[model samples]
Target chain A: MNLLPGFDDILAAAARIAPYASVTPVLRSAALDTLAGAELHFKCENLQRGGAFKFRGACNAVWSLDDGQAAHGVVTHSSGNHGNALALAAATRGIAAHVVVPEGAVRAKLAAIERAGAILHRCAPTQAAREATCAEVQRATGAELVHPYADTRVMAGQGTLALELLQQAPGLDALITPVGGGGLASGVAIAAHGIDPALDLFGAEPLGADDTAQSLARGTRVTTVVPDTICDGLRALVGERNLDALRTHRVEVITVSDTETIAAMQLLWSELKQVVEVSSATVLAAILKQPQRFAGRRVGVVLTGGNVDLQALPW
Target chain B: MNLLPGFDDILAAAARIAPYASVTPVLRSAALDTLAGAELHFKCENLQRGGAFKFRGACNAVWSLDDGQAAHGVVTHSSGNHGNALALAAATRGIAAHVVVPEGAVRAKLAAIERAGAILHRCAPTQAAREATCAEVQRATGAELVHPYADTRVMAGQGTLALELLQQAPGLDALITPVGGGGLASGVAIAAHGIDPALDLFGAEPLGADDTAQSLARGTRVTTVVPDTICDGLRALVGERNLDALRTHRVEVITVSDTETIAAMQLLWSELKQVVEVSSATVLAAILKQPQRFAGRRVGVVLTGGNVDLQALPW
Candidate 1:
């Protein structure tokens, strides 16, 4: 099996998950456009199934398995949108989903996972503990492991967003998405570039979790930085295969401070009138930070998710 | 003057404002559907140009004026979405807008009006004082008076939303909207019933400000209810012409307490992933309160606005 999804994979995934995921609306705000001095077409994945673009990848992965492999179910480790996404995706196929959630995960996220009928297994917050818990769950249930971002199927599924976006708002000069494990950015880079070779690819990274930026600069993967930003959805280390796609596409990574992200989050909420997550704000923040880079250009911004704890808003 | 808009006016308004206002998308939530046991179609006027349905009426009213009248501009006494809508509408015509705002209005709303290029005129927080200020402004500058809801032209403008909703999600068994001055409700009543006379129409009102409900029962308009709800947008007494439409169409007004409205507001924010104002929740609250009336039916709900101050969320 190919380790990285090609343009063909994205096309197939679009048809595969067409029955499940939403073709979330592309929103535009004259106010936001004026503020950034760029024509922005916001692909509102925050309104996607499970309230995030993770649903696209998770649904594709869960449904891609053969009957024999699918009967055994699926298992993964995620403490955020991915876990909630997998749980909902598995339900579509009448299969069990085992989520290995880290200890001290957000209470709201955990509750949402359980609500989707997934059996949750708690483990220490450390990466080693999370992997071990996932391994044990898989061993016991004979469920296939579906990594949130590293797998080719997941990346292809996420790439479907670019296809829909390009069709919805044609002639985009560039596209930007917040990079967590590089799943969305990598998938989008491949798909967008495949469609328009000269289109620019950009990733927004939190300054506190600038591992993607660091790895790109060093020309190799780096995972030593400890994340300390309020953008909970973007702290994961970049997946190796995911990084390869980003590197191949020459994706430019832009780092934004927490303060900037929060301020942009407020602007998005007020101007777009959409409840986007804090992580989603990074893309807008990046564009505003370097207006000269984006001025007078048509930009496609993927609002990655909207699963925020309202009571705990930073502002 | 007709004093009440008919189907023809709604069609005319639709054509007039087509160039200015957005045809806000209709959103659905399976979770909410299961919870309510009804297929709900949310007409998201919250995503409208001025972040509210008020823009439809404001835009129509502003553009409907003849060149002679348009040159002098327009004036309105409003402390909420209407002021913002009128300001924005007037800007489209390159004419001045004079807004008479009451004392102690929400600071965010005032700022939005000013940002839209309307000159603000402050008045004592009383109906008589508000009218006096508006009259004074109109006399000084031949600016035409555009009442928020009572006027026929304004009602026709608000009715345009019903035209869009019916086309977007046809075969609706019923429609519901929050009744403030009954602008949206009255206008929607005429438009919906004109399209399908058998369609049911309902008005959601705050228990603390249930003047419309009380008026309907007494066979006369009521104007003595001192508003006392968290739904700041629904505090106005129902307009005479607006009440006439409601009464003529036999609209059933359902009053909900602050507690029920707040709970429904939270559900909307979570399930719909939209930042609807507290007032917008009233329609959902009314539907959820009387499930028997709405069960197994397709209900078109008008989300009035999304102008709530995030810092002062009721929940």
Candidate 2:
């Protein structure tokens, strides 16, 4: 319940992940800026190690563990970027990584986790199944369970990206990131607000997966029915801590459709030649959908990841 | 003919285009390195302004002339990257751009050129018609001509990429690029030789558009009958002057099939999350086709462009 990381945690995470993570370039899109009548600066976290910003948190978490704790290694449940990031971070430290991946996940994602020397444990195709299997693996191997988003360390680690962005582009009118499980969005909101309380923070959630948007409106973490979103990475229900952060920070929740996300993904590829996954597309989608809110503003958006299954890109 | 520009010309061109052009990052692909058993240092000109490296030469050529030239603006014949790059560069320099594009060229490319504030002069489907009309436009308006290749300034400008690459990765054993009208290939050879005469320079052309490969074998320029390559940017025959440059440099010529080029493009996109057009895949195709020549050595590959027709990606 008291798991929210403070500003100090984020600062410490920045120091820990400094050596491993890339300081991705902040790019101004002439085309997108002109289209939206806004000055948009994109923080390209998609270009970071593991092709996603998740590596920042994962690397910090894996490296900060004690020698004995690291020897036993880390375990986590993720079907996407977080799995590959933790796997790679663990391998870099010569420690073990046990990823309890759900069945029916992309083969390429699984291959990436394995290639990074992470031991894969398949489970039933459900969040409950993934978490339960992850628990079992932790019990069997005495591995430290690395919660992808809920862990204070992981959240602190993710917040470091915002710290870098604020340092690089000070006084950006607003900061926006896509919300899936709200790990990155929560972390970004906290970091950006810490730097400047007046800085507006927003979460772009896919329309099909608008759990966060609904919860933000209801002023509580609300459970969702079965999800349906072309953007695979934004399918997670909002967490309690993330909901509190969203409520506390007054993070505006805007939703964009699958069509807009696909259009945005193609634009990045066509204009910037930056191949990003649909998850990253959500930020662009939200901006395009709510142009009035963002127009004529100096806004910063994080392209959170780039681990797209090319053959299976969301149409 | 004593028509070529000396080192000073290239330096001037670099200075001219520096303001308008992107200092595109040179990326290293570890997965690709392992596959070929060689370190692949990719000079990512694909991410250059206008989604192609042509911006360098085009910008240089368009901006090199005096105030009179700016008054008349510029004209060129291209079915793809050259047209778009020239148009965008001309727009950035606050000048008019006249593009003589052949019918049957990609509609998307034509739209991009138009969007960049270029006046479109569409002609018959033949390259000859396009060139003839471009000449007419040049003669009528007295507009400065920025030849796609085979111009002293353009070749020297393109050579700048090789200069940067060599400076970035001095230990490179070889430099490889796709040849289309021999502009990029010839410039790469010249720059590579200028950096180190021992550096092996090779042109990786499409088998269907293997005019350069055949011409080198014949000791003169030999045009291919009908270009059948899916590498659309490499369909043009090598310009006479560019051929001479290649021959003078004693550059080795290699050819790969469309299948290999597409595969290489997909590999680069999926593994590295870099969205490169098919033309940029030539170097990788050659290495995959003849791994023996490249294994156990350091290779520098110039990804010439990434202005792909996204709807028509040959994935």
User: Evaluated with DockQ, which candidate comes out highest?
Assistant: 1
The prediction achieving the highest lDDT against the true structure is 1
lDDT of 1 at B302: 94
- Alpha-carbon deviation at B116 in model 2, angstroms: 1.2
TM-score chain B for all models: 0.98, 0.95
TM-score of each candidate structure, all chains considered together: 0.98, 0.95
Candidate 1 residue lDDT tens string, A142-173: 99999999988999999999999999999999
Worst 10 residues of 2 chain A by lDDT: A218-227
lDDT of each: 0.93, 0.84
Docking class for candidate 2? medium
- For candidate 2, write residues B1-315 as lDDT tens digits: 225556667777778888888777777755788888988888888778777889888888877778876889999888688888889988887999999987787787788899999999989988689779988999999888888887877887788888788878879998898888888877777767866889888889999899889988988778654799888888888888888888888888889999998899988887667788887898898998999999899898889887777777687
